[model samples]
Target: MENLKHKARKPLALSTIFLRYFMLLCGGMLLWLGLLIGTYLIATATGEILPANYVEKQIAAAKDILVSSPEIRPDQIPSLSDYALYTQEGQYVSGSLNREQAQKAWKAVASGSKGGIRGYYTVIQREQQQEVLLLSYSIVMNYRSEWLRTHLPNPELLGIILIVTGLLLQIALWSYLFGKKLAKKMKGLQSVIGKIQNQDLEFTVQSSGVHEIDTVLDSLDTMKNELKASLRQQWEEQQARREQISALAHDIKTPLTIIRGNAELLSETAQDEIQRDYNRYILTSSAQIERYARELIEISKTQEGLKLERVTIDTASLLEDIEELLRAAAVEKEIQVHMNAHNMPDFIAIDKDLFQRAILNVVMNAVEHTPIQGNITLTAEGKSDSVCFTVDDSGGGFTFADLREATKQFYMGDRSRSSGNHHGMGLYITQSIMLRHGGQLVLGNDEVLGGAKVTLEFPLS
Candidate 1:
């Protein structure tokens, strides 16, 4: 019984079951109506089959009583068989018995005042061969109450059973549907999560058409995209750092080897001049070591967020100082050093130390790359909005693509111009400094000089 209750509660298709029950209710009402009509018709036909003589005698006696008195009232009638009537003016008038009233009177006559099954009858009266005769018949009301009481189940019990069954069916159907849909959505989420757990970032979950579930999946997708981007950026940074370290090691190795060879030569030599030359070589090697260490420390500082301390510095004095420092190196390479500044402002806001370092690095790069007798021009052009500095070196020009990625940390062009220690951070730091000062660093092949050109644009005060 419990299982049956569960089944009823969980009917397979709700729409189909409701339609069936509705049809059953309509058919039951139609059948009940048909039974009522049939019972009424049968009762009427049975009344017609009753003896006519009985109805006639009762009707004649009622008519005679009504006629004998000029005034006849319903209450003063002599017999149950007599009929009475009242006029419209409230006077007593004579009347014959009607079908309905005679039916009640005949029940009293036949059952001695105990009504005959509480129904209607008819009476027919006639005077034949000087003898009065009556014919009476009755039509008992159809006892539908008795039929229902005997055959039908208790109405309250039946109603409760139907209600319980319907509720159980609906609950079962909804539960199954909910469980199935939930499982489907959960499975999809599980698959996506499993792929993510396995480090498969490319997997995407299909939307299940459920709003809440789809919203969660969309959020997961967004998180995955962000994670992928972060990982990719980290990987690129790691690769750049690795290349920088390798270049650093290579640059230090050559100087260390030279220093070691010079030390050994100094130990083996006895001549004063040879000893002196060895000492100079040792001094040069030591200076190179110190330079490398300083460069490494500067790079570390830059990486750790070096901030510029602004000060008013004379642009002309700054240019003069840089030219004096680089003149001997340019002379050795037979490179012409030209410092051209026309209409230059006297003072500009700058970090005197870091800005000098950044600019010197770019000048040194130009000097190292230019050939003998190459012209290296450093020009500063002052505009209303900004100050532009251009360093054009007469050397082999770079490709279009190489200019774009030249400022990237540790990025070197495919064509090697110098065998010297080049970590490729000089231009990168120059670009960084320019950006920090609300300016930009641009690089291209010089249109006229046919060499590399670097331009730094700084905002005016």
Candidate 2:
């Protein structure tokens, strides 16, 4: 049972909950409306019957008086001054009758003397022993007033019904509008979440014209953006670490190879002078280790973020400097290093030191990859928006995968074919420097030289 309960899923949305509550409220309002109308009808019916019962009570009281005083003369009866007075013509009269006139009128009616006509009459009689007057009276009941009471609702009850109905309608309308706005906001948020799930972290939720919903959406958007930024930073850091490890391995391999070769030579020999040779071999290995450490430190400092000192660097002079630096290495390999320029601009905006390092790295890479007697050509050309430096070699070209991963740190195509000093950090650092200068590095197969081509394109400004 616990497992099953755990497996039970949460509701997909809160909309259903809101809908349930809204429906309940609407139902309650409808019930109230019904009750209001029912109460109005009941009150109207009771209101109509109240006046008739009051008139019946008054008639009964008059009959009691007549029965108690049978000796009263026709002109000496008790007056109904508290009741509404009317004339014989059924119009409102000026004044009410006195007790004597009331008694006279009642006695005349009991003695069968017709005085004035009335409508809807009821009579109560009493017996007497002596020759006495039997008092009677007529009342003209207003049937129009009674009919109105029977058919029409009381004003207060009607007003209550209108107020309640109006309130219910307002509640329903407001709920409908709020629900629509809520649904729209929810849909927008759902779309944003869907995009986020698909790893598209660039979208934002649109406002839904509701303050609370918009505020929530804004907060979610901010959180998603922060998460995306953090993840991207972590990924970049991981990539950097992997590259560092690969570069470290590459840097250590050369000394290890030389050490192993010298050890093998010493093992085959059986002379006392072999110790001196082994000592020299160990010293050489130590030197290589020192060089590797220094190079690693320089690489680390560059990657840690070097502040650029901007200067206008002459492209032609920079190319000459690179040529002078690589000439010795090229002479050792018997490779020809050629530098050429056509329509080259004299100066470009750059940090002279960083730009020189970037250019020298590419040239060194070309020289290292090219075999003996191969040609390494360096060319510079200025276009409208950018200046391009191209290095073309006549060595074996890179594979498709190598070309794709060329700028990645410690991504070497063939270690044996590369120069012993090759640590695969040259191109990676070159690419990073180019990016800092608002430039790019392009790697492809050199169609003309049948070797690798590396182009560094820098913005003209």
Candidate 3:
């Protein structure tokens, strides 16, 4: 008990399963933040330097060309297409420049300003004259390139991509690792419960490393083993009882035959009328006893389950035979027996003897319950996937208990409803035979006949 208590308390210990997962989540967030910050910093630095470096390179190249030669003349200077040279009097010189552009460049240079029109510029004294030089470059390239560079996956956008990618990758990795650690055990439990719901207990339950789960699985395994053993023991006992019944029935048959034969002989040899009646009673009782013995033997065989020997038979012929066989009994009782087939198949596959016996049992049960001058109807009809055999008797209908337990073995109703000769296995044996043929027996009160209604339904193969 102490050990069990300790086991139960194990899960409540200061365990780190949740803590570990929480830490993994925190680490993933940290990684996403780190990647985002790093990407943003790098992209921002590059964004700043790229356009500045491009403009600086262009300015440096132009400066190198102008200052590298010592004897260069203003008229013979190389063309600076991007720059507009201007005199201190606002006149354009040594470069391609429109009048307005030249005036704008000269104004900035002559006013001793540092900036130029449309772009940056510088003013310098000429090498041999007091005339100042105005140098300007177009602002279009620098502004357009800088806008494109900053906007085509800019720093903010790159940072967002990096963070999203990092988070997604981390989530995938964490989910895979977590599932590997626990999902397998949960899946095993799910499979076991699913099979149990289906009433399948054949598979083995393995232990999960978790104490609580392993305990539950162990308990389930133990329960399954106990149930299996119990069922086996019950099956063995039922088989042994069937064997004893079969042996007893076999042992009684010879003596019953002798008694029947002796009674028959005595009926012929008897002189007085009373002696003949006594002999007749002996023969009748002997026949009933023999029938009981036969039924007992059949019960034993039926309990062992049925092996069918199938034959093709038609519904019309089958019904006709039943009517003809029971015609004498009905005539003796002054009862009306009717057998009919409607929309029944011409041919059906069934174990002819067993099927006939099952039908006869139900019909005879009705016949016994019915009063003289009453009506008994046996019906056969074919359905979509099966055929139905029904018997109705114009007698007292079944009670609720009869409807519930009529087909159970050795079940008898009240003395008023039950026959003294009945051993109560007729409907039970009939139902068992019907089940063997993949069919069923249904019992209900027949309103039309004012009696019991028994239906035997057979599957069409």
TM-score for every candidate vs. truth? 0.45, 0.46, 0.59
Each model's lDDT comes to: 0.62, 0.64, 0.69
State the lDDT of candidate 2 residue by residue for 146-245, as single tens digits: 4554565644555566877777776877678767856865787678778878888876466544445455667777878798999999989976875675
Residue 375, candidate 2: Cα error in Å is 2.9
| Alpha-carbon lDDT of model 3 | 0.69
Comparing 1 with 2 on TM-score, the higher-scoring candidate is 2
lDDT of 3 at 343: 85
Query: Which candidate number maximizes lDDT?
Result: 3
Candidate 1 has an lDDT of 0.62
Give the per-residue lDDT digits (tens) of candidate 3, residues 199-270: 687887755545666666667677666777887898898788788768977988898888888887776673
Evaluate model 1: give its TM-score: 0.45
Candidate 1: segments with Cα more than 4 A from true spot: 1-303
Instruction: State the displacement of the C-alpha of residue 69, model 3, in Å, after optimal TM-score superposition.
Output: 24
User: How would you order the candidates by TM-score, starting with the best?
Assistant: 3, 2, 1
Q: Which structure is stronger by TM-score: 1 or 3?
A: 3
On a 0 to 100 scale, what is the lDDT of residue 40 in model 2?
52
Off by over 4 Å in 2: 1-19, 32-303, 313-316, 413-421
